[model samples]
Target: MDTSTWIGIFSVSASAMCMGIGSIAPALSEGKALQQALSSIAQQPDEAGTISRTLFIGLAMIESIAIYCLVVAIVLIFANPFWNHVIAKPGG
Candidate 1:
């Protein structure tokens, strides 16, 4: 295949790999955060509201990492900067 085709394949493969692997840490972090929050709540029932609120905010922050990864993957697969360079070549 040509360079562009190979680039496309590689981009898609890398994007898929990024999304598949990038999500793991955030998932684990969110799970762990929730676990700790629950444990804290159990230990201090009166502070449940504060713990729950902090947990949700922390979860949202953690989730943003995955969202960023997804954005990067989408950009790689659908709007790759290399594609522009390849397409802009005089002989392309």
Candidate 2:
């Protein structure tokens, strides 16, 4: 109803949506990557070392995306720029 209340609602909704989508993507990616890595290792047991090393690096990179999304969601929910603006308005 009020400007501040609206901003708070919007911020929370945005953060929840961001975190939900962000987490899903990375979860799917990690699952697929793990499946592929296992397949590769199965096909070439001798190259397990190299394949495993590469897999770990790739996993870390994929995980970073989720981490970034989490941070963004947290910022949006707890430290939203829009919140400051709305709260600062007269009679907010």
Candidate 3:
């Protein structure tokens, strides 16, 4: 019922939402991107190398969004900025 308790609750819930929603979107995007890349490579065998290279770069960029979400979730769960604000109160 206290400030810290509320902070902990909110932080955990927020982290859960961040990870749950964030991971799904990127995973779907990566899957779609890979599928299209494969289709392109299959259609143009001679350009397989370039297509593969570009796919890797695109995948990395898309994956970065997931990585960022992970960082945010980790921070919310383990090192939430709001925790400091609540804990530093004079009567906390």
TM-score of each: 0.87, 0.86, 0.87
Q: Ten consecutive residues with minimal summed lDDT in candidate 1?
A: 83-92
On lDDT, the stronger of 1 and 2 is 1
Once model 1 is optimally superposed onto the true structure by TM-score, how far is the C-alpha of residue 19 displaced, in angstroms? 0.4
Query: Clashing pairs in model 2?
Result: none
Model 2 stretches astray by more than 4 angstroms: none
Tens digits of per-residue lDDT, candidate 2, 7-71, equal: 88888998899889889989999999999999999999999999999999999999999999999
Question: How well is each residue in 2-90 modelled by candidate 1, as lDDT tens digits?
Answer: 98888888999999999999999999999999999999999999999999999999999999999999999999978899987898898
Off by over 4 Å in 1: 88-91
Q: What Cα-based lDDT does every candidate model obtain?
A: 0.94, 0.91, 0.94
lDDT of 3 by residue, 1-92 (tens): 99899888999998999999999999999999999999999899999999999999999999999999999999997778899788788877
Worst 10 residues of 2 by lDDT: 83-92
Cα lDDT, model 3, residue 51: 96
